[model samples]
Target: MTVTIESVITCPSCSHQAAEIMPTDACAYFYECTSCHLLLKPLAGDCCVFCSYGSAKCPPSQEQKGCCA
Candidate 1:
């Protein structure tokens, strides 16, 4: 199976969304909403914001290699 690196992250505060390329070496813990400027963090049990709000999981999670601590 090929793991996709692209993720469409949606901002919960303002519903803004963006397609971003996830880095394979690390997890993205925070994301800022472009429309509302609200800083987002991983929700409980989520390793990164992408896992919690993105259409695709973070690269680490996609590879089943675990994400942020």
Candidate 2:
């Protein structure tokens, strides 16, 4: 499967959305929402903020390779 690098992260607090370029080599452990400026972290069992709040999973997750492996 082709790994996707783009993800849309929606802030839970304000419901604001932003498109982000996912890092291929590392997990993005934290993200700050552009609109609300709320800090976001990965949910339990997820590798990155993208996996937690994004419309698409992070690149590693999409590729089926364990994130940070």
Best model per lDDT: 2
Q: Name the runs in model 2 displaced over 4 angstroms.
A: none
Off by over 4 Å in 1: none
26-50 per-residue lDDT for model 2 (tens digits): 9899999988899999999998999
Poorest stretch of ten by lDDT in candidate 2: 60-69
- The clash number for model 1 is 0
lDDT tens digits by residue: candidate 1, 1-69: 698999999988788899988888888888888789899999999998889999999877887888764
Q: Report how far off residue 9 is in candidate 2 (Å).
A: 0.3
Error of 1 at 53 (Å): 0.8
Provide the global lDDT of candidate 2 against the true structure.
0.91
TM-score of each: 0.91, 0.94
Give the TM-score comparing model 2 with the true structure, all chains together. 0.94
**For model 1, the run of ten residues with the poorest summed lDDT:** 60-69
